[model samples]
Target: MKNTIIIIISILLLVFIFSGCGPEKKKVAVLIYDMEDPFIKGVSEYLKAFDQKSYDITYYDSQKSQIVQNKIAEKLYKEGVDLLVINPVERLSSYIFVKKSLQEEIPIIFFNREPLKEDLEYFEDVYYVGTDARESGMMQAKLISEGLGNDTENLGGFDKNGDHIIQCVILKGEQGHQDAEERTKSVIEGLKGEGFKVEVLHTKVANWNETKAYRAMHEIMSEFGEDIELLISNNDAMAIGASKYLMDNGYFGMEVDGVVTDIPFRIVGIDGLEEAKLLTKKGYMYGTIINDGKSMAEAIMQLSEYILENDEEKLQYELVDNKYILISYKYHSNE
Candidate 1:
């Protein structure tokens, strides 16, 4: 009977040891700007597929509202989440969410849309993962310059009119958006540096919505007709929208006596998404600058691991002051 009791106690001790040795599942909450944005959609998909061995992830969609984002963030904090990942709907309004999370001592990783610098400085545990907007803009101009045959005087082939000036239309994203403003200004500056005398026919704000881009492009086409030699969009969605309108109106890919006479106009965009890459491969889009979503995901995971382990030395990348993990841009060719 004593020997039986010893065996039972040993079994109980073994059970207790195993139960205590099991790793605690870290609770991670992710807040997205909107699942509607394809780039953010891709990132959210990746985050969802993250290894369950390390984290239990819960996702929340802000639906592009600051109030909704703040409310969801507060709820996540109250739930005792170990980490918070956010892609703010409106960057300028991200302070509310960041402040709340920081005050609660929860580590936050801000992806895609960047919060203000002051918000990040409030806590060392905060980080931002995104690319430099100016790089994409410069890349778009390089593609345009290359398409013009790299001849400063000739403006590549963009100067379809013999007038020696390139007439271009800008399909801008959101009006007050940081990406839109930087891309718009940098592309023009880059083009000027490439020795092209550019004449801006019109600049229209499409709010980064495809439907709005379609409507705006249609009107611009009606006014400019074939006189518009180039089209520069802040993102691939807008470029695709404008391209769709042009294709539907028989302005592009016209057949002349059984021969496909494609329009000579070049269209450049940012964000080398899969759809955009496919379009580029089909010669519909001129080219695009890659916004690396995978890199952003990797960075977020690395930062989260650093926070959880409390070992900055184990981090894959040292968090730079200001902590901007700017992903590099790759130019996707339409050729």
Candidate 2:
């Protein structure tokens, strides 16, 4: 009995020692460009929910400034972070981040806003997680064109002006943003491919802000008025902004039954946020393409684990060609 009691005490002591001396928890630094963005906010929440508890994640909001982002990154490195997940303020300005990652031998997962492909190819320790911006645009066009009923010849519903051409006003995101450029260009191209001759009344760069989008829509309404048949935005925030303005001006309104009615102009946007989905369900917005925040968060976490653990099999399954893990968008329509 004495020997068994001694054995139990020894086992308890060993457990305490090992628990106290186990390897330090890995630290992950996540730098987001703007925390106020709805889709990004959703992604952050998902990341928190899906964390595996093996590592500690710290999120820093750069507030849409490259200098701030750089400083935050430096601070994180000084604090001994094991990995970085960056949604850059400027995609092309990733050189500084890349250099730091190389110097410190830390892995980086560039999600959402992507750096150039050439820049990505420059390092083996870096990866990008995002959907093809053009795909969102294609889906937007598909929703719009399909709603018009005719695939090619008749552009009846969309060409609300009774002319053969559809008058469109584009609410673009940040001016040099890659996603903005691609989404804007591809949507136009997709429309043309569907035989809808587009007359772009104006292209307003709203910097992805709902307030800016509201102001831009107000100004555009002053100039173009009802001549604009379709409002296409790079994100749902801008669409919401436009919708609010339309609601104030009698172009859109909620009926007695709580359904969104009186939507005269067909409106569309990307990034199917919950609020946007709710609006779509109410028949306010025509449609939106859902950016899968859950999938993105899962991929980021999986890749982070693979990097810190050096698990090549996990890495292989997480990425395609050891570089990009592109998520696909799902379409949601209220039409």
Off by over 4 Å in 2: 1-18, 151-154, 253-256, 313-318
Which pairs clash inside model 1?
148-156, 148-157
Predicted structure with the largest TM-score when compared to the true one: 2
Candidate 1 deviant stretches above 4 angstroms: 1-21, 50-52, 254-261
Poorest 10 consecutive residues by lDDT, candidate 1: 255-264
What is each predicted model's overall lDDT from 0 to 1? 0.81, 0.85
Per-residue lDDT, model 1, residue 122, is: 77
- lDDT per residue (tens digit) for residues 112-190 in model 1: 8878889888777788888788888888888988877777665666666778888999999888888899999999999
Q: Choose the strongest candidate by lDDT.
A: 2
